[model samples]
Target: MLPCRNRTGKMRLGASIESRPAEVETRKTFGHWEIDTVIGKKKGKNAVVLTLVERNTDFYITRKIPAKAASAVNSEIKQLFSDFGKKPEKIFMTLTADRGLEFASLAELENESTKIYFAHPYSSYEREINERHNRILRRFIPKGTDINKISEEELERIEDLINGLPRKRLGYKTPEELFNEQLDLIYRL
Candidate 1:
């Protein structure tokens, strides 16, 4: 796989993950997210899940997408941005993603309030939160299982289960609790 930056030092993808603000790395603030895709099968461009986990609270969001193409990913992302139905821009400060073709169109979404950063090819560690949560998600949607068979209700149940679990690293607080609290604060502002 080609690195995000080429020999000429030009970024073939979007901006480097290193260029993301310091607060994002430290998870000192909210709204920073790490995103990735979970495919059911690679045989065809069937269905997939677009997962986004907040860097700070580990609040994960999943969307059942039609395919792993740029259009599907971008559409779901835009839908997520509008989930709040108002002042949606304030909810997505930045997003860190891998150098996949599905993410190629993400650079177009970058603006004043929302920034998009691409991790170096083959470097999954940069999106650790997303990777870890994906592992947990695999418990429900195992590899080789056609995700298209999984109904949206089942996916939401799995997502809720994960978000409701208390984590020691999070001071024993559930991600859902913290996520809702933070989201409330954002909407209030």
Candidate 2:
């Protein structure tokens, strides 16, 4: 992977994660998310998985893309946000991602109520929640496995299994429970 600077010359498009608001760090807000792409084995025209995890609730979302191109990834991101309905900004307040070229167009996601932040180079820990979720996904879809062979139903099952598992950090509640609670709050607001 080339350095993010190599792709954009001098100017980086988004704010650094270090500049992210304190509320985001505390994970008290429901809208902040960390995004990443999980690629299948290196092969001709291999498909990839686009993953997003809500910071506060650890809610995970994934979509399969034809490839790891930035355009495909951006399109999936747009579609995901569009699924949130009229005011996507209300549900997608902030997105933090690494400097992957696949996320190069992430700035297009920013709006009046939403912002995008890029983690510093070589700092995967900054997106810890996302990384952890990806690791769990690997249990079902091992590395080097062809993503093209995985059906949507299988992916949904994997997602459900991960979200349904209770977590001690979340007071033993499943991510699905907390995520649903947050969504209810958002709707009630």
Q: What is the C-alpha lDDT of each candidate?
A: 0.89, 0.89
Q: Candidate 2 lDDT, tens digit per residue, 1-189?
A: 965555556547589998889899999878999999998899799899999999988999988999998899889988987898776777789999999888888898778899999999989999999999999999999989999999888888899999999999899999899998987877787
Q: Per-prediction count of colliding residue pairs?
A: 0, 0
Query: TM-scores, in order shown?
Result: 0.93, 0.92
Steric clash pairs (candidate 2) = none
**lDDT score of residue 61 within candidate 2:** 91
What is the Å distance of residue 45 in model 2 from its true position?
1.3
**Tens-digit lDDT track of model 1 for 1-189:** 966754695448778988889989898788889999999888975899999999889899988999998899999888887777787666689999999888989888888889999999899999998999999999999999998898999999999999999999899999999999988897787
Those runs of model 2 whose alpha carbons end farther than 4 Å from true positions after fitting are 1-11
Q: What is the lDDT of residue 56 in candidate 1?
A: 87
RMSD, every candidate, angstroms:
3.3, 3.5
